[model samples]
Target chain A: MREAVAVFRKQILDTRKNRAVLIQFIMFPIMTIVMNSAIKVDDMPEFFYLKLFSIMYMAMAPIVSMSSIISEEKEKGTLRALMMSNVRPASYLAGVGVYDFQCCLIGTMLMSKTCGLDDGPWWRYLCVIMLGLVISIVLGASIGVLAKDQMAATSLAVPVMCLFTFLPMMAQFNDTIAKVAKFFYTQQLYLALEDINNVKIGTEGLIIIAANAIVILAFFVLAFRKEGLTNE
Target chain B: MISVTGISKSFGDKKVLDGVSFSVEDGEIFGLLGPSGAGKTTLIRVLTGQLKFEEGSAMINGKEVRKLTGADKKKFGVMMDDFGLYERLTCYQNLKVFADIYGVGDEEIATVLREVKLEDAVKKEAKKLSKGMKERLRLARALLAKPKVLFLDEPTSGLDPQTSSEIHEIIRKRKDAGTIIFLTTHNMTEAEKLCDHLVLLNEGKIVERGVPKELCLRYDHQKRIELVTTNGETISLQMDRENAKKTSSQIAEFLKEGKLSTIHSKEPNLETVFMELTGRKLEV
Candidate 1:
C-alpha cells in the first residue's frame, strides 16, 4: 500500500509537469463546460451535450492520458528505475490507474453537476460511472505495459482510442455502428448515463458494462503476467 | 555475494550470452568490460533478473536471481545504460521516489544527495541539470537505499574526466563500505582504476578475467623497454637478456643525458588485453 502511494506521488508530480498529458485532462472538462453552456439549442434532448462530452472525457482522458504517462515513463526509463527499487507491478499500475481514475471521476462529477443530476444520491451515480471508468484505466495500462516506448504506445493506443471514442459517437448516425457500439463499455456507459437521467439504469446495460470491465481487467492481468516480470 | 555458473541467454536464434560465468564477493568491484554489443549489459540484466536466461544458475545475496522477490530486490541498487530518471521532477523529487520505495525517511535522501554532491541541485529539475550532474543524481538514486550490491552499467560512459573521477571516488567509497559492485564499462582506464577483478566480454563470451594489472601482464607478450630521448623521441627495444648488454649502452645514454623522463616495463593495459583477445577495441 505504501509503495503504491509512493508511485502515485511520483506520478502525480510527473503528470503535473507534463503539459501534453495535463492538456488531455483539462481539455475534456473545459470543453464539456464551455460547449454545454454555449450551445443553447431548442428541443435538444435534456442532457445531450452533457452526455456527449462526458462520454468523450471518459473514453479519451483515462486511456490516452494513462497510456501516454506510462509509455513516457518507459521511454525515459523511469519505469525501470521504479522496478529496480523493487516496486511490484500491480502496485505501480494501481498507483498510475488511481490517478487517472480520480481525475476522470472529477470530470464525471462536473458532467453530473452540469446535467443537474446531483439532487439525488450523486455518490451512487458516481459509483456507477467509476465502474465503467475502470475498463478504460485498465485497458490503457495494458497497452502501456505492452508498448516499448511512447511512440509505439501512441501508435498502439490511437486505434483503440478511436474505436472506443468514435464508435459510440458515430453510432448515433449509423445503424450498423450502433449495433456494434452498444456492446462497448463506453456505449453501455452512455446508455447507463441516459438511464441515470431517467432514474432507471437498465439491467442489461449494467451487465454489459460489468462484462467489459472483467474482460479489460483480465487483459491487464494477462499483460502483467506475461511482460511485467521482465525488467526490460 | 553474487555468483553465476554457465549462464546462457538467447533471443530467437541469436545467442547473446554463451556460457558466461563470474562471481563477485563483498567489497569487490567486479568490472564487466566489453565493446559495444558484447553482452555486458545483458549480463547485468540477467543478474538483475530483468532478462531471463536460458541455461545455468545465478545468485545474489544467497537468493536465486530469477526467484528474487520484490523484497529481495531491496538489497540491490542498479544503474544501467539508460540512467533512468524522472526528468520532469527535481533531483530531490527523483530521489524521493526511491526513498519512499525503500520506506526511508527524508534524512536518507538528504544524505545521498550530499554524498553525490548534488545538494545544491536538489531543487533543480532533472532535465535542467548538466549531464555530469544528472549522472550524479542517478548515482545518488542507486545509493539511496544503501544497498548491499550495486549493478552499475557504464556509470561513467560519457562524462568529463573530473566528473568521472568523482564518480570513481563514490564507487570506491561504496566498495570500502563492503558493497559488492558489479560494473559494466568500455572504459579500460576506469576498469584498471576501480575494478578489483574484471572480465573481458566479447561476442557474449568472456575472453579474459583477472585483476586489472594481472590480466594486462598476462597478455603483455611484448617484453621491451621504452625510452624517451632528450630530443623528445621515443625508442622501443627488445629487452631479452641476450640483448641486455647492448640495451644497457642505450639505456645509459638516455639516463646519463638525463632525458630518460620515464621508463618501465612496457606492460599492456586492459585495452591491449581486450584487443589481443577479441581483436576489437573496447570502444570503437
Candidate 2:
C-alpha cells in the first residue's frame, strides 16, 4: 500500500508536468460549454450540447490518457525501472489508476457544469459516470498493454475513439444509428444520463453496460498476462 | 554469491539461451562478452529474475531467482540501457522515485546523483541530459538501494573517454566494496580492464571462459617473435621449435653484433580470440 501511494504520487506529479494531458482534460469540457451557449434549438433534447460532449469526453479522456501514458511508459522503458524496483504489477496499476480515475471524475464535473448539472443532484450522475469511466479505462489499458509504443497506442485507439464518441451523437437523430448504438456501453451511458432526472435508467441498459465492462476487463487482464509490464 | 546451472530459455521455436551455466563469488566482476544476439541480455534477464528459464536453477544471495519476492529484489541494482529512465522527470525526481521505492531518505538521492556526477543536473529533465548524463542517471537510480549484486548491461556503449573513465571509476568503487558486478558488453577493452572472470558467449552458448590475459595466452597457439635491428630493419620468427632452431644462430649473431634494438613476442588479444572462436569482430 505504501508502494502504491509512492507510485500514485509519482503519476500525479508526472501528469501535472505533462502539458498535453492537462490540455486534454480541460479542452473538451470548455468546448462543450462554448457549444452549449452557441448552438440552441427549440426541439432539441434538454441538454444536447452537454450530453454530446460529455459522452465524447468520456471516450476521449480516460481511454486515450491511460492508453497513451501506459504505452509511452512501456516504450520509454520507465515501466521496466519500476518493475526492477520490485513494485508489484497491482501497485503500479493502482497508482496510475487512481490518478486516471480522478481525471475521469474531474472531466465529468467540468462537462456536467456545461449544463445546469452543478446545482442538481449529482449522485446518479456519478453512478453511471463511474461505470463509463471503468469500461473506457479498462479498454484503454488493454490497448496500452497490447501496443508497443505511443504511436501504436494512438493507432489502436483512433477507431475506438471514433466509434464510441461519434456513434452516440449520430444516434440522437437517426433511428438506424439509435438501434445500433443501443448495444454500445458508451451509448447506454448517454441514455442513462438522459433519463437520470426521472430515474428511468433501464435494466437492459444496465446489463449492456455491465457486460461491456466485463468484456473489456477480460481483454485488459489477458493483455497484461501476455505482456508483463514491457517486453525485452 | 550468484549461481546458475544449465539454464535454458526459448521464445516460441527459437532458443535464446541454451544450457548456459556459470557462478560468481563475492567481490568479483563477471563479464559476459558477446556480440549482438549472443544472448548476453537474455542471460542477464534470467539471473535478475526479470525472465524465467525452462530448465536448470538460479540462485542469488542464497534465494532462488524464480522464487524471489519484491523484498528479495531490494538487494539487486540493475542498469539496463535507456529503458529505465523517466524522460520527463528531473534527475532529482527520477532518483526520488527509486529512493522512495527503496525506502531510503531523500538525502540518498543527492548522494547518488553526486556519485554519478549528475548532482549539477538535479533539476534537469532526463530527456534533456546528454547520453552520458542519462547513463549516469540510470546508474544513480540503480545504486539507490546500495545493492549487493549489480547487473550492468552495456553500461558504456557510446561515450567519450573521460565519461567512460568516470563510470569505470564508479564501478571499481562498487567492486572494491565487495559488490558482485555482472557486466555484458561487446567492448573487449572494457571486459579486459574491469572483469576478474570473463565468459565469451556466442549464439546462446559459452565459447570460452577464464581470466582475460589467461584466455588470450591460452589461445596464443601461433606465437611469433619480432625483432628490430639497430639498422632500423625488422625481422619475424615463429616460436615453434623448428623455426626457433633455424633462426637461433642468425638471432645470436645479431645480438652479438649489437644489432638488436627491440624485441617483441606477439600474443593474441581478446579481440583475436573472440574472432577466432566466434568468427566475427565485436560490433564496435
Highest lDDT scorer: 2
lDDT of 2 by residue, A186-230 (tens): 998888778546434689988898788888888899999898678
Worst 10 residues of 1 chain B by lDDT: B221-230
Q: lDDT score, residue A219, model 1?
A: 89
State which docking tier applies to candidate 2. Answer: medium
Task: Give one digit per residue, the lDDT tens place, for model 2 in B1-284.
Answer: 99888999998898888888899999899999999898999888888888878998999989999999988888999999846677788898888887888899988888888899988889999889999998999888889999999999999989788888999999999999999999999999999999999899988888999999899999999888888999899998788887777778778989899999998888888899999998988774
Displacement of the residue A150 alpha carbon in candidate 2, Å: 1.7
Residues A12-48 of candidate 1 have per-residue lDDT tens digits of 8988889988887888777877777788788988767
Docking class of 1: medium
**DockQ of all predictions against the true structure, Cα-based:** 0.76, 0.67
Q: TM-score: which candidate is best?
A: 1
Taking the tens digit of each residue's C-alpha lDDT, what string does model 1 give over B38-65? 9999898889877889999998988999
- Model 2 regions more than 4 Å off: A37-45, A118-120, A195-200, B225-265
DockQ of 2: 0.67
| TM-score of candidate 2 relative to the true fold | 0.92
